[model samples]
Target: MSTERRAPLDRKRVADTALKLLNEVGLEGLTLRAIAKELDVKAPALYWHFKDKQALLDEMATEMYRRMVASAALDPADSWQERMLKANRGLRAALLSYRDGARVYSGSRFTGTDHAREMESNLRLFTASGFTLAQTVRANSTAYSYTIGFVIEEQGVKPLPGERREGYDVQERARLLAEFPLAAAAGAEIFEDYDRHFEEGLALIVAGVESWTRLG
Candidate 1:
């Protein structure tokens, strides 16, 4: 029983509603009925634009990349590490904007033109710095791994579900800290130096790749 009227479906409109649904409900709760309700249309109307939910998601992923924060493309004249790090950080920050945004955005297999252009820029920088196309792709993958891994940690915010969250019991923390001094101390410092740690991880990958330079 398709209740949708005989009107044509615009894929972009469907995509916009899908993104809104993702932001409001997160990926787990996303559904075509929800989007249809939001758009004041029928679920079958959505089918005209997207053959299935997977098609809808693929389109939404591409749209998200285009709508993500605007970072100036990589500087080709910079060193390989410099250009790559800038792109990595920029992409991470863009995806960090929405709730559980990185979780949805990063996992999708997006091969849009915007991503292609960004990679071409990185390859130019790396090739200039003595890497073949294959080497550049390897380094690029490693850089991406560091950034997404870091963002996954940052995005996993497990606070109290409501306004009842005030502060944790310092005495309890202290007792736990006494029992596991090193782990507690490290955990406390994680809050203090997350940014520094992110850079260190990314730099390690970039520097490791640099060691493979063909120079004598």
Candidate 2:
């Protein structure tokens, strides 16, 4: 009789497993019990690492942030605007990687001080680019808020890539808005090509920040 010996359980192991299961069950269905079942452990085992679901979510968000940082390809030679674009694009990609990923990351706090490093880097970038510390905070916050809000809406329309919810069909939307010609014609723009739309919006934000900085 052969038996399998599982690896020891830890917070990282639990969080990693939870991220995987997130894609399958989504945030709404994900629970400590579900994660424990997937890890082949009891629910109480998770409590030792995470006192509650919110704690688990915080770890999951931190893991997502870590992966985003690892996969980012920020060029040192690029301007601050370019860096903002790259960073926010990476953030959007990270949030869209898993089902309800944005939801998981939206309000969750990090379990560690890992985010501080990136925060410091961004602050330095803006301050060096002639933005006051206050402006730096506002600019970064605006861009970050835009990215998060965009992904939240994007995910709401399509929970997973290549999968959109009902009632979002362009033609159906057009028909529903038939009485309003302009609104009806806008369906395709609103419902399709999120990538292009995101880029355009990000560019606008960068430009706005530049103008705001110059004015100040």
**Per-model C-alpha lDDT, please?**
0.69, 0.90
The TM-score leader among the candidates is 2
Count of clashing residue pairs in every prediction: 0, 0
Q: Which residue runs of candidate 2 sit more than 4 Å off their true CA positions?
A: 1-3
Task: Work out the TM-score per prediction.
Answer: 0.78, 0.96
Best by lDDT: 2
User: Candidate 2: lDDT of 76?
Assistant: 61
Model 2 lDDT, residue 14, Cα: 95
What is candidate 1's lDDT per residue for 1-216, written digit by digit as tens? 988674445877788777777757766778888898888887897887778777777777777777653545445568776777787777676656555566666667663465677666667777777788888888788888778777666656421122112334344555778878776666544543456877888888877887865442
RMSD in angstroms, all models?
4.9, 1.2
lDDT of 1 at 88: 78
